[model samples]
Target: MLLNQLIKELITKMGDDELIIGHRNSEWTGLGPIMEEDIAFSSMAQDKIGHSWALYRILHEELGGEDPDQFAFMRSEKEFKCCHLTEMPIGSYDFSLMRHFLFDHAETVRYNSMLQSSFLPLQQLARKVRGELKYHTLHADAWIIQLCRAGEESYLKMQTALDNCFQLACGIFEAGPDDKLLADEKVYPGEEALYGQWIENIYPVLVKASLNVPERKEPVYGGRYGKHTAYLQPLLNEMGEVFRLNPEATW
Candidate 1:
């Protein structure tokens, strides 16, 4: 694949991941265990969605892609490249917290690596996203540590959530056919390398929190190639319910 093609694929996948996870986080709007948590998760949801919009804008302006809103909300299920990890519903507070911890760390590392991208647009955007992610990881780390240390009950829940999410979290690093082009061209580090850094970054926090990182296993794949779980299509339909009614209608 050409370099621009590779960049577009990588960026679109990142954008999709951010957008889906934002939606998942938003599901906690009024249902959080506490009011403060409800507000916090809602804030993070906006951040993630905004991050996705910024990335999609880069795709549109720098990579000759479609308009950001149409490309994001109007795409079919098979056109989305988000990982299965992001598609899973926010089952419980524990699951959502654990997912946030795992996924945000991966996102942090990925954007940090992108700071050095040969592609200037991505490099600039990554720097901005990386700043926002700093607060995200901070929120995640504080909660993970607090909950893990609250008591045996909280600790056990966190451990179980970690166990449940580990494999799916690994899917964030699913390798793609064009990854080498990005790696070789310095547009971004390949997923494997970013995965390693993510592990390293999160391991210390888990250790400090007295939690066990789940044992290594096969990473879920196929999302990058348009494969997704049953939940995604429904999500798209709901997300686009208003948009599809009149694509050009001004709010």
Candidate 2:
């Protein structure tokens, strides 16, 4: 039962992260810089939302949690455990692109590690999610490399975006008390190990793009425990507005 608590906490954080980022990505639906990017972002947003729904279902069916819709849409700000990186508003194109790159890489590594989890449900889901994330990262990498090497203006923009988002990106690896327990149980490697893997995974891409990886600093934390930015509640309010009116209604 205690192990179930650990698994529930991990998946809840993952689902919330996916839900919030999907909302952010979908904001680019009509605002993308190009038609191709517009379509790609929309597709990726759908994928993230679907991933979140699947995670919530695993929680509900296997871990004794609420229904997926209720669990995702009805949670208050304080109840969410997503990291601060995912909670921030999608800023400029460069910022959003950089975020997509950094966040997806981290997610891919984490899910890849989860392939070995002792938790059977998560292990199975991880296999499927990892397959999807391959395309997500490939898109992110192509765009990042193309833009960063395109010219001085685009290069500078990406560099600045990377600098601005680095700290927040670091926050994605925020550790929890149960991390060690989960690691010991082979639920997944601890966040710190996953964090290291993420760094290695992303470093070469940045290097190839001629973008300087920002130096490590104090990672903005607290979101995992429900401490979030001012931007999150507004996003949540908008996200839940439709559902809040009639949460019990089947859609």
Candidate 3:
């Protein structure tokens, strides 16, 4: 693929991930274990979707992609690049919390790496995104530590959540075919490097929480190439339902 095309793909993938996960976060709107958590997840959901809109605008305005609304809502399931971790149903509170911790840290590492991207648009956006992600990660880390330290039951639940989510979390870094070319051009550091940084970034937090980081597990891949779980199609359906009803309607 041409460098421009690869850049579009990269941005599209990131936007799709954010949009889907943001919707998932919104699912907790009134359903959080606590009122504070309800608001927190809802706020994070808005931030994530706003980030996606910014990314999609980069694609449309800078890269000749379609309108952000049509591109996001009208695409088929197989066309989306969101990882399975984002597609999975928000399970129990433990699972949702763990997923939030893992996913947000991975996002933080990626945005930080993009702080110097050769792509000027992404680099500029990264400056703004890094600030927002700081609080996202802080919230995630604080909750993780507090929950784990609460008691033996809470500790074990968090540990189990970590073990269950680690592999899926690793899927967030599924390598792209153009990763090397992008890396060589300094568009952004490739997935392998980002993956390493993610592990290093999250390791201390997990250790502090007394949670065991699952070792040597294979990352669940295929999301980047459009292979998704059964969960995704339904999510896409529900997400785009309103838009599908009236694509030409102004929001």
TM-score, each model?
0.97, 0.98, 0.98
Clashing pairs in 1: none
List where candidate 3 sits over 4 angstroms from the true fold.
Answer: none
Q: What would you estimate as the lDDT of candidate 1?
A: 0.91
Q: List model 3 lDDT by residue over 72-122, tens digit each.
A: 999998899988899989999999899999999999989999989999999
TM-score of 2: 0.98
Residues 2-94, model 1: lDDT tens digits: 888888888999999999999999999999999999999999999999999999998888888898989988888988999999999899899
Instruction: State each model's CA lDDT, in order.
Output: 0.91, 0.93, 0.92
Stretches > 4 Å off in candidate 2: none
Decide which is better by TM-score, 1 or 3: 3
- TM-score-wise, the better of 1 and 2 is 2
Clashes by residue pair, model 3: none
Q: Which of 1 and 2 is ahead in lDDT?
A: 2
